[model samples]
Target: MGRHSLPDGSAPASTGSRPGARRRTIAISTGLVLAVAAGSVVALRSDLLPFGEPCDGQSVRLDVAASPDIAPALDAVAKTAREGAARTDGRCLDVKITPRPAHEIADAFGQRPVDPEFQVWIPDSSLWVDRVDAGSGTPLTTAGTIASSPIALGAVPEAAKALGWPKKTYTWTELTEAATTDDALRLGVADPARSATGLLALARINAANAKDTKDGDEADTRTAAAAKLLYQRVADGDGQVLATLPRDDSGAEQGNPRRNQALLLSEQAAYAHNTGEDGGPDLDLFYPQNGTAQLDYPYTLVDDDETTPAQTRAANRFLTLLSEPGGQRALRRHGFRTDNGRPDSEVVDAAGGREPQPYSADPADPPSVKELQALLGMWTVTVQSARITTVVDASASMANPVPDRGGQSRMDLAKNSLLQALATFTPEDEIGLWKFATYLDGNKDHVELSPTNRLGDRDKDGTTHRDALAAAFGSLAPVPGGATGLYDTTLAAYEKACGAYASGKFNALVIVTDGANDDSSGIGLDSLVGKLEKLADPKRPVPLIAIAIGAQADKSALDRIAAPTGGSAHRVDDPSQIHQVILKAIMAAGSKGPR
Candidate 1:
């Protein structure tokens, strides 16, 4: 939700009691000489200004784009600045504060040319600036910090009291546990890919989980696991995310079951909702003890060749005016703090005499761009339930005993691991089983044991696919001196997966192999990869993940096949580590969409 307008709907008021008041209100635009051409005042366009009609005498125009939350206040400031006929050098200063979606603006910086008139952009946080800078390779100058808001947990008073939020501090782990496992507390958050607040909350959780493990892949794995749980909670429920918040003033109780507990939101948002008359419920703020992400409303200058020197001067003057008492007053009236991070009297009064919690100016560092990219990728996979077809290699090599295990065949271990992996999946996940070996069934190397359907579910034959698959796995034995028929089986499985692509689910094919392709009658590696590449669709992806179970497996060939479908190939020499290897395969299986 955007920032709320002042309750009284008044102009910028003087908050003299604020700590370190800058100066008395000064009207910088009064008594300005009109710039006339042909003895007529130049009329401005209504579309340029977000709110009022254009100023008649204004000559110099400065365009400012701000996030929607603060757009109202900035628009009010611009209107006041225009009414005063503010002057820079010898012409009237006209400021236009256009409201824009933060994500759209970041995307435009890299894919489209920025509008020529925009001189400054004030996004809700420096994160947007970082995104643009990283994407376009253009350096944006940070003018200064305009306002400060921290992401915090907004819990109903009852829930807050149960968690001892205000009385005792809690870490993100504790909070996540309560929401996911400890007590099944409903948790609501925004989509991290789109919401800075959501991203910060998830980042905090990931960092905490990372700190508890040794650095390297172990740390990444732990963080990914924790983030997976967070994503699952949101994915499995509806009406709990920020985008779907209930609109009723009475709030969660007659609104939606998903939103009846703690929600993640910015400090200003929580205060605005709580202070409103007849607002839903009393929300207690929970500030994590390990620190939180702050939105420092970065005032950034858009430096490009298209901007003229005169427009630059006008922009600089507009910023200067905003720093003045009147400009700061407008900001304060809208529940924003001064540039120095001190809340104005208006905010304090709205808080019912309670002071906003102070947080470390230097909070825990946010994830790097690369780390964020990886995290988002992981979330994309785990957020959706999956549909998978497991294709197992039952060639003669499967009968080989594990080098470490005394007598267990590789096939036996693989079968057990597959069963264990099923426990990791929710009942909603759909799965099927297949086996490939030379001349296994009526001269066919590959044959399906069960049809693709929801696990633990009965098919048309009145037999549960789960039981059928388990029976098939337990009874399978290596064909006498059989060879691997990898190419034909993989091609057929890929076709089946593509044909059965399910919407709103991660659809994939998992191939568990023990050796290289030895079938001379089938398509070659190059031809198979080319065909897979051509068949793969970004809009409806079906990645083919391959797990090589032992040391002698052909990893290079598997990589070639998986690369075309945006999947990965994993090699595990130790059969005991198959569980971890399957987790890796699951991540790789669903990783084939947009960045």
Candidate 2:
């Protein structure tokens, strides 16, 4: 739109001289400027331009952060949308795609349960939509399809044959028995805590809170009962439950071999990565010989202060695009079911090689505030896990060596780091404080210290229960006990952080520990992991971050806990580094995704 004057006396063109056609040139040039401006204006307005067209040159960026389960499909759809928008409106559409597992989808946008900042959230189910609504007070305003393959079990042909896939329906008994008795028949599902499919599968097993009526044809499920069932089964059985995953065609990438051999995830997710296209084996799918639950990936809206109207608009547009023909085709290619298309043969085959079952999802389910309350209620109980409770070693071995940096006693550095870590949280972050090293009873018992108010339960002005949090982290004086119960304490910390808090708050469990597992006092690590395995939430996760100090720091164990819980673990090489380590722990805990 910049202006330019015609050079020389072009105006003289009007005065004879083959300067003829002067009026024609002026008219043509003027037309081009107006045309370009009009085109730009039109381009600026559309988000999805229809099929076969390029993205608009001026559309706002439609950055989509999707759980990995649906990212591929969405990315393809977005690209098509960009093309269409461009062709129709002469606009530009730029798309940025990031992938994460389903559980972390909520955290990508908002600070609290009710908030999300992304233009769109494509989690694996309407269940996620419901959970967020409970916290944010509505189904994320943006709408998206709950399009997904039925939640089913995937088994290799040989495994299916052994499990009696076609002849007998596969039941919980089959899965449990395989886990307990058949070491070679490993079961796979993403970690329920991090993946939606895992959580959904657990819900099915626990008959998850199936509504209970006082005396009607009552089949109501109690959340506690379900938790007990799931926790007991996994904790008691030797199942390979993966917490995080390796990204690859066959998922054959190396990891801590002890963690797991298989994963828990949606049937579609399994298909997308493990099938022929990935140049891997032809995975067989089983609908568990049981009725399948539909996994609806809902497009949600984040309502926290961080949300903006553009996000809403972009999200809405994205939803519309998903339903459009171009988006539909792309979703189909990625194994997503469509309103108008053939069932994905891959999905059909893995579904126990059976016909696709009927499926439906209700995104309009009103958010239940009580559900949020219920999830929150679980937090407190999770914290009091029996797995936690370590033995502290106050032996002569303790005082001699230091954790090196700037020469502070290992214990002193750990304490200072913890204190500094506490400050990293603003009033908004929910932090559960716990301190070990001292036994309250002469019998050497670990104390819960004190409890702090729940996160997001703060007053309108945003003040939290500061005093309780302070009391929990009061001191770390070692008591007259055996060696430090590093393993047991870590176990206990896991339960406290993931188990004790209420839902609807950011989960950050920061543990400061010094050495080996010899001083076993609290719950054992295996038992603690057992409890953690059953952990579920329609909302946020209870993240655990730890800092190891002293010459005796058990960095390996700490690292294990942090990775599975979506946090970090570090060894403070020097006393001066403790503060930074603590702050990092706090930040890592506050962060969302993975663990």
Whole-model lDDT, model 1: 0.66
Candidate 1 per-residue lDDT, tens place, 1-595, comes to 1111111111221221112212121222221122112212222221221233344664787889888767777888777877776665456677888987565676667444465358788777666676666665344666456676667777666666677656666676666666566443566776666666777677777787777654655665656666666664452211135333334435446246655466776766665665656446656777666767666676667767777776766665666556566777787677666656654555644532233343333356656665555566556655666788989898898998987687988887888888776656655678888989877776577999877787667768887766676676676667668889998889989988998999888888889888999888888999999889988887888888898877788999999999888788889876555656766666544432543
Q: Estimate, for each residue in 338-414, the C-alpha lDDT of model 2 and write its tens digit.
A: 55223566555543355432223211122232333233233223322211111223333344446334554655554
Estimated TM-score for each candidate: 0.72, 0.47
Alpha-carbon lDDT, every model: 0.66, 0.46
Candidate 2 has an lDDT of 0.46
As a whole number from 0 to 100, the lDDT of residue 349 in candidate 2 is 56
Best by TM-score: 1
Candidate 1 total steric clashes: 0
Provide the RMSD of all predictions against the true structure, rounded to 1 decimal.
9.5, 21.1
Error of 2 at 341 (Å): 11
